[model samples]
Target chain A: MSVVELARPIEKARATPKGPRRRVTAWHRWLSPLALLVVWQIASATGLLPERLLAAPADIASTAVELTQAGTLPTAIGVSLQRVLIGFLVGGTAGIVLALVAGLSRAGENAVDPIMQALRALPFFGLIPLFILWFGIGEEPKILLVALAVSFPLYLNTFSGIRGVDGKLAEVATTLKLSRGQLIRHIVLPGALPQTLVGLRQALGVAWLALIVAEQVNATTGLGYMINDAREFLRTDVIVVGLLVYSALGLATDAIVRLLERRALAWRRGFLA
Target chain B: MATRLSGVARAFGDRVVLDSLDLVLGDGEFTALLGRSGSGKSTLLRALAGLDHEVTGTIDVTGSVAVAFQEPRLVPWKRLLANITLGLDAPVTKAKEALAEVGLAERADAWPLTLSGGEAQRASLARALVREPELLLLDEPFSALDALTRITVHQLVLELWARHRPAVLLVTHDVDEALLLADRVLVLDEGRIAHDVSITAGRPRHREDPELVALRTTLLAALGVSPEGRS
Candidate 1:
């Protein structure tokens, strides 16, 4: 019998008992968050909570609809997304390329790694003043800020991932007589991919953070610009809407990475869900 | 001869592992090497497999050499069939045939991590056999298996070896395992072959047979273990 066939009965047996209990726990997981939202809504309706400090959920929802209909929200989303995408592409590419250069050869490591390590130690946000002075308060500084923020996580993860590839597998490659390029392609890079994906996820997160920080400074567009405009007008509802959009975008990107992980790492059986 | 090593010397800093070790392997011959824990069994095997180059020696092999390590060493990312065909220009049918030979045909699409220990080892063997090596080096591949699985795999290996006629050198610690599977057994000690014995018994030989039992005692003695369990 096939191994899968042999394993079927046991899997069915374990799954049956866990199925209903899992559903119960999944619902329970959302209970606290839902309860908090209800309480906040009630407090807003009863006038126990003031709108200036925090807008009610109903107010935030209505503001979200108004902004969406007025085309402001959509435009801001589009602008912010473009910034992140371009920055991510630039930074992610640079990170992977640098990681490959350092990971693949001793000379590459000696030439590139020490400088990267030193640069990584400086707080990335601290570079904003220097960036503004260097590149001006245009899209250049904003995008470059995001790119710089995104690159380090990817570089660190991909580099370590390449180094962490099993040496035994490398020996197997040698025995199989794989060429140096083939060895890197088949053994090194694929083995390093899981960590690189981790780096990608972190970079995406940091890209959004960097965009927000960069936008807060002398900005003309994007969600941060919308929030800055909302603050001058004391529109707590609009500010909350902008923050909610940022969080939703973050969650959406994370979900994309999770989907990619599921597809790419399906070979890793028994990994936690 | 399939392989020959002359005056092979290997040392790890000050400690000598293989001191002037000389050995020869006949074509299609099955040899079992036994040794105490630190007796350079793996060192010699690694040297022959071309994995260790620091050794000073004249070593020659007739054709391709394939090694199956103790852990199977199948790339965990690759499927069973892909792993078998790794680095080879062979067609998919050849890898499929090799998997079938190892009794893992149905698991050709399965990931390496999903396989049981025995199944993984069989896949390792399939990988080695697919190359059709002139020399097959097994570095204690079966030691990680449970007893029942080990016996089954032992039979499977013998069957494959019989068909392929590869010059097989199996490095193992078990005395009975060596006697059961090998035509010739060599005991390694302190960096050299301390003793060599030929097993002339027929196929499907029993452990209880007077000849094998006597040879086992002698082999055990050569490995510095008393037959009666006394020091």
Candidate 2:
């Protein structure tokens, strides 16, 4: 009520300088990577590290530029990106559909969950030989491998997310007389989204890893194939460039998912943004 | 009567939660239920809300029913406004109006997790009353709030119930809260109504009023808490 009381809050606000501190923290994030790059450049310049074993950061950068100019990098990247996109679509949809069927009913869960769990325990990449035998060395096995890798995390997370919805909230639905469809659309799906996003982030990581492995095994194109071909020529710089491309793509996909999370979960004020 | 339950019996694994409960809640009447823990108060409320369906009962409610639980079960993922009108055909404008009615118009876009306990409970009340139900069941909706917030919510509920005129069944363990809010107070014991007292006290009745004090003493005795050591 008093002016002094109001002025005290303003005084406190003036005392706390938040903006500069936040900007400093943002800048600090890149400090470690830059340090690592500087170390690598120093080691290469001093000739302490042999060029044949590992490419210098500068050489990798210039080689990336060269590969881009030659169109090899861009074409390989485009192919790899398309494979991940399709694999994600196929795997993500199946995971959601199976999660819904299992999460909603005990009968569906009983019929589906154990088999999924059994399959989930088997390292999917180990089936590459079987896949090659069955589908032959083509895009089919590679895409399927990526899809298989992406599915399990999503299925598990989505299933748990739906199961973890508050029973009290569901009781609210009962009182509202929400139809079955309304219940799923409004309550179940949104409640499951937080966990589903966790699964999505994990699936994104696996999808990229799967694509790298699938392309490495029997591929004429993509970053994996480029890295493999450079290995024969002992072109460490080109291999490093290929690996960097994969890492950048992985980071990009994860960043996209993070953007989706922020948009979908704006209602949540999590401790970490 | 807006709600009726006859020969209603519910059990869980041979443990009887409600035994042959028979009651009728009058239209637009505010009724409070008081009981000890494990006295089947929640079982009865859940039955009325149709949340407990395994019960054998002839239950009839005149129209739609809404319930607000003790924990203010607003979905964490929805903003307060969306939580109020979730799964209902109501528009955002109606949700905003409901929030305003509960003195939370400024919190329409706020997340449920950001709300204080009292604010969340208010949002819960708004969520229920927005449905314009014929019956509104409250399961200790204010028990989690501090004393000051509880009194504010008591007044808010009174005002809302007065305007809406829904048949309200409030389940609480607070004797004073029951005496203050309800036109009729029912005490449950041993899976049935043990005391059904019609409160004759007028609106804005003082807690210190002899009639309320006497009724409070009676209700406390029914709850098996001795009233002998008080001032």
lDDT of every model, 2 decimals: 0.92, 0.90
**Which runs of model 1 end up more than 4 angstroms from their true locations?**
A1-18, A270-273
Clashing pairs in 2: none
Compared with the true structure, the alpha-carbon lDDT of candidate 1 equals: 0.92
Clashing pairs for predicted structure model 1, backbone only? none
Q: How close to the true structure is residue B166 of candidate 2, measured as C-alpha lDDT? A: 95
Tell me the tens digit of each residue's lDDT in model 1 across B107-220. Answer: 999999888999999999999999999999999999999999999999999999999999999999999999999999999998999998899998898989999989988988
Could you give the C-alpha RMSD of every candidate to the true structure, in order shown?
Answer: 5.0, 5.9
On DockQ, the leading prediction is 1
* TM-scores of all predicted structures: 0.95, 0.91
Query: Tens-digit lDDT track for model 2 on A212-254?
Result: 9899999998888999999999999999998888899999999
Per-residue lDDT tens digits for candidate 1, residues A62-146, read 9999999999999999999999999999999998999999999999999889989999999988999999899998899899889
Span of 10 residues, lowest total lDDT, candidate 1 chain A? A1-10
